[model samples]
Target chain A: MKLDEFHLERIQSQWENIVDYNLSESGVEPLRLNELVPHNRLQREILETKLGYPQTNGSIPLRRNVSSLYEGATEDHVLVTNGGSEANMVSIWNMLHESDDRDEVVVELPNYMQIWGYSRAFGANVKSFWLTEGDGAWLPDIEGLKDMVSKKTNLIALCNPNNPTGATMKEEHLKAIAEIAEDCGAWILSDEIYRGAELVEQRTPTMWDYYDRVLVTSGLSKAYGLPGLRIGWIACKDEDKVRDLWSYSDYTSIAPSMLGDRLGQMALEPAMREFIEKRTKRILKENWAAMEKWLGENEDIMTCIPPEAAPVCLVKYSESIKSTELAESLIQEKSVLVAPGDHFLLPQTIRIGYGHDKKKLVKGLSLTADFLRGEE
Target chain B: MKLDEFHLERIQSQWENIVDYNLSESGVEPLRLNELVPHNRLQREILETKLGYPQTNGSIPLRRNVSSLYEGATEDHVLVTNGGSEANMVSIWNMLHESDDRDEVVVELPNYMQIWGYSRAFGANVKSFWLTEGDGAWLPDIEGLKDMVSKKTNLIALCNPNNPTGATMKEEHLKAIAEIAEDCGAWILSDEIYRGAELVEQRTPTMWDYYDRVLVTSGLSKAYGLPGLRIGWIACKDEDKVRDLWSYSDYTSIAPSMLGDRLGQMALEPAMREFIEKRTKRILKENWAAMEKWLGENEDIMTCIPPEAAPVCLVKYSESIKSTELAESLIQEKSVLVAPGDHFLLPQTIRIGYGHDKKKLVKGLSLTADFLRGEE
Candidate 1:
């Protein structure tokens, strides 16, 4: 039961609110309740909701809405959870528990570190492959993934539209990864929380279509900009596997908040879903312009491979200071909070979240750039 | 990583929603949102809440309110979680992780089995002591607990105003249990979720005053009838330990829902807290009359030690049928859902929840009595 600290979340939980500019968040500026429920009729329904426990897995309407996002799936294929974090926790816990011999887990790196820390705590022998910058985008090292998998690997954990780097694996790459997992008989746990907040028009492809054993985890936190709801889900083709995962949640948190389930269903209804998606894209599009300008201005001291999706991008800096030290300096001297690359196991870099108030983000970036130049 | 199914929760989760009379719930009839937020000023604040992540541990106001329930505690001593279930999950997970050599956990029974299953799944050597029916009350066997503990005992888990049986441990019993735990240098995890729902005037005494190493887990779920909010917390004397537990939550569910924190603050505000407590007592007092009448009518076939607290009482039946079989028969023949004693690790009994609509409670009890007498 010994566990290593999940430094990425630890640092944020401590400093995100304390700093003047919190560039540690991975989602866009959130929507207010009034904004989410604009109509009087729906607001009445929400207001009348009894503060009783919702269905442990999810309300049928909520699960039905979640299932609609994926192709040819239904409510039976989904198990709703507190957030994308628990979705991964239950999936990995189940995968490890289901097999007596498969104690190994292969994880994709330069990603959020929840699964990495949890898997290791649960006694899995964890291995990793990385996504490296190349040819104007962050590319998966598929060859490395192939070399890492074996009969012992029970799960291949992934985060697409990845954290920090904001890299999205192509459909072809997903298919290749699925093929490798198929050969070794490992389940693919693809985290698609950031799939909808793309910089481009085309939505990022899900790993659902690529593998029969895939369990895709996503939520309203990132793409829909509703982290306050704490709504997330896991969708698998195997109904029995989904039921088994639902049982595991009985130990974690019995059920999602009743309001979360109701509000989440409204947020995912066709028109409302379209509205939230548009808001995310608009925010990203607006903020990315400022982010690009900031990067352009700081090219002398820093550089970044532009992110394809999500509110965050990893900026590599040319500095002798350690990533944690730089992050500490930013908090102490600049009153800014950027996720320290050291926490993500990628030192000499920092992850910047540019999804809030544009003016504040620009000012925060300017202050960070000034600090990098050793300016007053 | 292997886990036994939490049968108590699994059975309720499957049938609670489908049953015509759901006596499976442990709390009173839930309050509507309008009832909770009756004032226009507070309703405005709720409506304006941005759908963003609240402070990870808890909003300071929420923690302050939670700490107010215990003597000489502050926000520094609290860690808010999704529910009392996760509160237990984090505490047991932390206890097992804190020491490499101390792996033994002793639990109180028959009780809610969350920690029993979770501690075992985390590789602890779990043992148990029980409360037996005696002197017209359910009493803890203090000597049995003394005999069970040793140097390797890392934790002693207890539920006060205990589940299933609704027995409240006296301060003397709690002190005795604390002494035994102190001899073994073990921490005490007291699930006090049912602390305030007393049938008698005096509220159940918490273990906080009796033990230094105790982590008391309680929430709005049971006593306050606000399970839909999914708000719970842990209170400990050590601030560092509270912070450590918060870090562990980073990998589970990162934070409680935003509205949960905000509305939870309102719910715990002195005036609102008193109002909710009165409501619970009123409901419990009224429902207990019906429950008592039914027990009197059915004394030929069944009997129960009158509950001291909570919305539930364990009924010992004279039927030869197993508890699970009796529960299955009730569900199939009468569309009623009562928690079977087999799920609580005690047989020849069933736990009945009589906290909702009075008419339904009377009807459900009548049907159950008819079944017992073979008079249908």
Candidate 2:
């Protein structure tokens, strides 16, 4: 029952709202309800929705829409959850529960730590392989993962279009990782919540395409700009696997909110899905300019790998201060908030989220620069 | 990492939509979004809400409204969760996490099995005390609970306006239970989700009034008829205990949905809260009449203790068939679904939900009666 504190979430939960310029958000400015349901017919349908439990797994249409994102998947392959957080939580729990002998978890590091924290919480022997910085790209250590996993590994977790660094794994690399997991006979849980919010034209590859024993967890929170809906899902090739995950979710939050399911279904309709993704790309493009300018201005004190996807990039600082202390100082002195690298198990770095409010992003960046200069 | 199947929820999830008549639902007909936000001001506010993560712990106004339900409490004393289900899940997890030595959970049985299942799932030694049927009331076995608890009992969980039986423990009895928990210095978790849906005029007593070491879990899903909103909260006297519970929720579902937080605040505005409760009372009153008539007409084959609260009642059937078999038959032959008493650890009975449409209720009841008599 003992859980090490999830420092990233705990710090954000405490400071995100109170900070004057919060640069800690990792998704684009969220969609307002009217924008999400632009047509009167859809709005009316939403209003008419009985605030009842939607299908506990997910409504058929919602699941169907979610399934459409993955080739050859059907409604049976999906289980809708409250958020991507739960999607990862349930999938991990299910994988851990499915096999009694395999109690070890291998994780991709410099990633979102939800899986890492939860794996440890569930009493797994959590081992990690890092995403190392080299030549302006954060690269996954496939060979390291090959060495780290074993017959005892029940699950291997990955965050594609990875958190903090926003570095993505190529299809070939994902295949190699999948093969590593397969060698150990472990299920792969790929957290692809950042799939569509790519900086480049090529869509990031999914672990689902490479492995039979894969559970892909994604939601509207990151790429789709609908975090408030709290609609996330776990998709697998095997219908029974998804069904088993749904049973685990039954013990968590029973169902997604009614509006989340209905509106989320609308958001995932082919055209609307394209529109939301395009909007995310557009916003990320616009905001990244301000971030680029700030990084350019503070090149003497800060450097970043330039995120390939997602709305965030981790900047390694030139100063010797601890990442937590640096982040705390930013909050106390400049009223700006950014995720400290310490929470991601990397020190002397900070993750800047540039997905929300261009002006605030600029102001937050400028204030952060001021703080960095003062430290110097 | 293994969990017992949550039969009640599993069965309901599978058949609630498939059945022609679903009497397995425990709450009244859910409120549509339009009904929940009838006023234009509220509607506009909802439409304008940016679908982003609200405060992860819940928005200030929502927590304030939740705290308002308990005397001498503040927003600091409350943590908004996905549903009353998560409220209980987090509270139990927190209590178990807080103390390592205490691993046993004493539960009130013939109850909603969520806490029971989750307690065992979390690796706690789960013990139970029963609710005995006597003189048309389901009475708590307080003495039996005292016998069940010890220094090792970490928590005691209760359902007020109890599930299945619609039983409400008197305030004096609740105090006695609290004193028994106090003896072992254990936390008490009272699921008050069904508190407001009483058939009688008097409100059900709350554990918050009696015990300092108590977590009262309630939400809009049940008594308020807003299951779709999925807004639930935990209220405790100690500010720090609520804070600790919020940390566990960080690993579950980070926050309630954005619309849930916003609209839930409006729903809990004093006037709106009163209106919703009155509407629930009205629906229960109108529907229970038809239920009463059906009970009277079928007295020869079926008997019920006449529930004092909630929209559900457990009907004891004369047939010797297993409760699961009878429920399966009801679903297959009658196209009606009722919760099997076996799911609640009591056989030869079925829990009927009569809070929805009265016509459907009547039809479902008549079909149930036909099914019961045919077994003769």
Candidate 3:
């Protein structure tokens, strides 16, 4: 009935018209239309074919592709949604509805805004586990996380290869979090949107592998670079929980776009799988190199905890400038767009995405460097 | 988290395999798609060129076209949604959210299931205003509705040119109901899915003309014969309510399908509008005649209150046969699917849809006649 201002959406709205050079984007250098698979001929054929209503859960082919991404997961365990946003919302709502005493949610701060936004929307008390800059890395305080968990905690939401900070949790840390969740009968909702884009790994071990209560939400948007298609899925081992989420899903979005489902399936094909993996590696390698070079040239004004996986890396600004002011100045003077750290609850940092057009990345970072040096 | 069985989804759900006849269904009395459009290249171009995200509320071009159907309406007053289903859901949720005390919803019984389903999903107390056989026509009793209205009633939902009964509310009666809604400070949600398929007249005046609180939900699915496109819109006179619904719309569905929006715009174009009007008149005229003739031949076994609009009419079965049993028998023996009236809260009746191909209708009716005559 009554809704508070959607904090993240409001921020997005503010930047909607300020398009100059988007240096602040959080995803991998987004794939151009030509970068997508099946070639133009195949895409044309798909567009020409009459697209009927997609299966509300997901197209079987797409679900099968997503299922293969998990070790023991089946098509039955996956529910394709509008996007990762809907996937997260449905999973959280289901978890909250399942336990009345579980009215609180624990999320890692300096994470994606939706993790906290959705938790708050469900009327849950959200406690954020801070990720701090120490020992040359942005690492989560596992002890803080332990303290945040309680008998009333229904969900523990985490973003692996985390947004903005790009902080990733190792298998040991995930297992530790899973143990706490299991003990308290809480579900661990690990947002793996940046899963496949990891710089060094073939794949990250999801929380779902460690605990049946864990729910993994991911989509083709980030790793596969198909945000325009708007296809996402939730993988859960609990059949009852899956069913409950499906029912709630019906009330939210009856079904995902049929065209998107088809494209997602194509993008997940065995051959396409290899293509995306190679593509992600290439993009990450180039972008990270560009970022390292730029940061080296501007060491006096900026420093970053190198990202382990995702294309995004958080760079702390000099004490002379606020992150927002620096970001605004960079945009206005250099026509470069980079996200301010405040969006991720870290005010002293700015998020720079290396994944973009190689030329644009080079040009934008140069402009950013020049702007910082008063050479613009 | 523990969820109730009713809330949990069962694996391999039933809804997916329901044999949606709307897809690829055609017969001798075929609903020819070409008859409605005469092969317009512009429509095809629009569908093909339609890409990228649609406006969150709706595509301005499509919304403008939809607004033209209403007197003094503008694009700002329309909120495009996934379908009539989503439109109805948004309006109901918004209305219930606006006032806490008015948490109950009154809906016309023997109407579409979605009307009540959405109300119940929103935690609204749902009470039905029944349509009984005491009336020569299937009409809502004004007195019954008056008695049903209470201080707690926040919304009232109805379908004009009703789903199962093909009952159309008179303009005077609609005005009276609108007056009651205004007096009680409740919102009126009119499902006008079959708006243009009137048997004789052009169409009834929409409730929107008389009340600022009325929300008219319609789609291209039924009368426009574009169900495959999956496009719908809600028109509200109040700008504040429109804004509120649009804000809620973002969280529910980020946007309607872009391709669907483009197709909807083309479908409402001047030429397409003329085609739809002509095709609707022809189909209803022929279908009504066929139904009348079938009823004339089987007067003793079954009878119907001749419908004024919509493609469906309820025929009362003889007291000897249960409506559900008769419907099941028809489906099993003849492969002619007709909904059991009990699904619409009419136990002694079965809904017969004459919107299918003429030969299918003839065969179906003949099969019914033979069954009644003890031939099958």
Candidate 4:
């Protein structure tokens, strides 16, 4: 029952109240009420029909819809979970048989807490390869990753368009990782929650496309802007892995919520898919532009590796102001909340999200800039 | 991952067809959905509003409403899950930390597959205490239970108004088991999904009332006739256990579905509570009466241990045919589906659920009796 300190939830519980601006979040700009489907009528009808036990795997229609997102995947390959978090947890728990003495897990550092947290929970030996800010961009060192591989390693977890850092691995880099994983005979789990938010024209290629050993995890919470709906899925090419994870998934969530699945299905429709792409393109373009202008205007106070895909970017403060202390001061002084980089093992950096309303993002950044300049 | 064969889903792929009854299930007769809640304009208004991420633990209103069902338990004690299945699984996995050297779990035979399935999945050394037909009433033998308990035992799971058998334990018997659990330092988890479906009483005494080491899990699926809602809860008296499980629960389900929570709250209202009680009482009383009449008329062909609560009973066929074969024949010949007791480790006993419409239950029993009597 004694959990490792690193596995504990590190996000301070107090600042949950900051409203209007939440730059700490990794998900894309969330859906407004009007954007959700059934639209109004469908939601009403579903609610009128008393919510009952949904299908154990997921509603068939929802599963079919999710399966359609991939080229050859079917409902059998898809397992709907509570959210991407559960999807990732179940996949890891099932793939990395925890009780086996030989089981070890490799996770990318400067990543979200979920991968390591669950890894530690299962009593696995988890090693992290640091993704440092080098050559003006954040990326994992190929040698560092190679050094972590071993015969005992059961899985390698990567978050593409990595959270906090917002750095993405190119297709060649992912294929290289896949080759290494195949050599080690380990499952490669790619958390693509932020997959659809690429700022550039080339979307990150899914690991599944390269290796049968890969499992792709994504959900509506991130790129689709529907975190509230709380629907996520895992697509695995291996039938045995699919069945193993499905069993674990049943224990976690007898099935995904029917309402969540329905809404998620609607969100994956051609129209919704195009809407999400457009939204991601619009938000990333505008917000990154705003960030560049803001940083340029106050060059002496802060610096960051510009985000290429996801909504978040990690910025280093000019002086030793302790990221946590500075984040708290920002929230208290200007009601602008950002995640401290210490939570992700990068103490000098702070994670700032750029996926809010244009006007609000501008106002918040200006206030943050003024505060950093000690003018507030 | 080399999972033990014990953890494998007991029913083969063919058994999945039995779940298809949901399409034709009559909510009025078996589940009594109508009396449970009356959808009004105000509730409809709430449904139309976009449901965001519900409280990760559960919605506050919904948790509070669920807490009101228990005497000493509060909202803090309740952890809402996807359904009774998740609640049971969370309790089992968190409580039973099976490692290489020490692992033991004792579960009731003739119980729901989920309880034992999850136990085995955790790689625990699982032992089953029988609820045999020879016992006449399907009660666990205290001496037999004591013989199975050991210092290494970490957990024991049971189903009240036991699934398939539908046997309800008296308060004193439950307390005795709790004492045994206390001596071994084992956590006792009771699945009480059919809590309000007692044939004669307004309410049944729960194991939670007898022991702090006990965790009581239930959901709105069965008695409330709202399985589609997929809302269930785990209430533990131990605060530390609650906290630990809450953390693990987070990895399982970030939160219950907001729509499920909202509808669950409405279903737990004072009016709805009374309505469900009345409906369940009527259905259980009438169904059992019809079943008793059928048993009396065909005493030479079959025998049953009359169920005290819930809507199911284990009926032993005098014919030499295995329960699985009989169940398959019934489904194929009559389009009447009933769960095979083989899933519960009872080979000759067929589980007959009286939760359907009175006429259907009567007709199904008649058909089953005719088939057993070689008159088909």
lDDT per residue as tens, model 1, A224-268: 999999999999999988989998999999999999999999999
Residue A300, model 2: Cα distance from true site in angstroms: 1.3
Q: How good is the docking of model 4, as DockQ?
A: 0.34
Worst 10 residues of 2 chain A by lDDT: A367-376
Better of 1 and 2 by lDDT: 1
- Stretches of candidate 4 off by over 4 Å are A5-22, A32-34, A38-45, A48-50, A98-102, A280-298, A324-337, A354-376, B4-40, B98-102, B130-136, B328-336, B357-376
DockQ of each: 0.80, 0.77, 0.24, 0.34
After superposition, the stretches of candidate 2 with alpha carbons farther than 4 Å from their true spots are: none
TM-score for chain A as predicted in candidate 3 = 0.93
In candidate 2, the residue pairs with backbone N, CA or C atoms under 3 Å apart (3 or more residues apart, or in different chains) clash, namely A51-B228
lDDT of 3 by residue, A63-140 (tens): 999999888888888989877877887787667666668788899888877757656655679887887778987777
Per-residue alpha-carbon lDDT of model 4 for B1-376, expressed as tens digits? 4544322132322243454331122122423223333456644455454545566677778988888877787888888887787798778777765333437888887776776766776667888786655456776777778889898887778888687677888787788899999998887888888888787564667888888878899988777767766788898877667767767666665667666777678789888778776877787787788989998998887888888778777777789998778777876776666667676677787777777667767787787777787776
lDDT for B285 in candidate 2 is 92
Quote model 2's TM-score.
0.99
- Candidates ranked, most accurate by TM-score first: 1, 2, 4, 3
Put down candidate 3 lDDT per residue, B1-376, tens digits, no spaces.
Answer: 3332221112113322442221112111222333433455642453344234455577789999999988889998998887776788678766866666888889987786765765675567998786655566877777788888888888888788787777788888798889888777778888888888788565866887777778899987667766545577899887777877876665555567655676678779888777776776688789778879989988988889987777788888785777667666665565555666766777877777786566667777787778767786
Model 1 in CAPRI terms: which quality? Answer: medium
Give me the runs in candidate 1 sitting further than 4 Å from their true place.
none
